[model samples]
Target: MEMNLVIVGLVFVVLGYLVGVKKFTWLLAGYNEKRVKDKNKLALLVGGTFALLGIGIAISGFAGIQQAETIMFVAIGIILLELVYVNVKMVE
Candidate 1:
């Protein structure tokens, strides 16, 4: 579990680079294909949020905290919702 969380963290960091720095719009899963009005802002907010969530989950897992898995899954679910919002709402 700890290793898995760490792996997810690393993936999020990579996603931050791809979505935030590289401006990769298609990386997100939503069907909304609208162009973003402010790519940099969206990138910074989503990328940073994901990065922090990933790190927090990893740390919790490493500590063997009870219910950490549940928390992590819930957080990931929330992130997915955010991704949809970014697609459908944040874009032009």
Candidate 2:
């Protein structure tokens, strides 16, 4: 169980990175003429959140708590969806 949680946690983190990088690249390329304050903030917020999430999952794996790991999954999912929304807004 612990090993599985660790692995699943890592996957969530990678997925988060994938989504974030995609959005960041698009933001940078599409808004080259703009100030890019929001883009920079988004990068920092999303990147830091994922880093913390990955570390939390790793720690939870050591502690062996299923609930904590599940919460992490939910958090990751929510973050993913939020990123998608942000990307859509950027297009408008």
Candidate 3:
């Protein structure tokens, strides 16, 4: 099993929960509270993305997938898309 990936994935999942469900927006990187147009929307979008990404990583790790690098690249792509979307639509 890919222990490293599993550990990282769990970290992401915890972060997601803290930011999304617990409303700990301060944990988010490069976040400016005053700049976000809607805090709830931002949390939901980013948190959901992180959580899903974590789940994917965890599953890949557990399955010992040979294409782990590919999965990571895909996850990075998704995160980039999320960043663009947040910057364009959520920021003030």
- At residue 32, what lDDT does model 1 achieve? 46
Q: For model 1, how does the per-residue alpha-carbon lDDT over 1-92 read when each residue is reduced to its tens digit?
A: 56766676677777767776676746766524456777667877777776677777767767766685687778879788887777676777
Q: What are the lDDT figures for the candidates, one per model?
A: 0.71, 0.61, 0.87
Which candidate number has the best lDDT?
A: 3
Candidate 2 structure quality by residue, lDDT tens digits, 1-92:
48766876686566447536655434322344253347655665565566567767766876887686466667769667856765665433
Clashes within 3 Å, all models in order: 0, 0, 0
Give the Å shift of residue 18 in candidate 3.
0.9
Alpha carbon deviation, residue 17, candidate 2 (Å) = 7.7
Report the error of model 3 at residue 48, Å: 0.9
User: Judged by lDDT against the true structure, how good is candidate 1?
Assistant: 0.71
Which stretches in model 3 have alpha-carbon errors above 4 Å? none
Query: After TM-score superposition, what is the CA distance of residue 84 in candidate 1 from its true location, in Å?
Result: 5.2
Question: Where's the lowest-lDDT run of ten residues in candidate 2?
Answer: 24-33
Query: Order the candidates by TM-score, highest first — what do you get?
Result: 3, 1, 2
Give the clashing residue pairs of candidate 2, or none: none
Clashing pairs in 1: none
TM-score against native, each model: 0.67, 0.51, 0.92
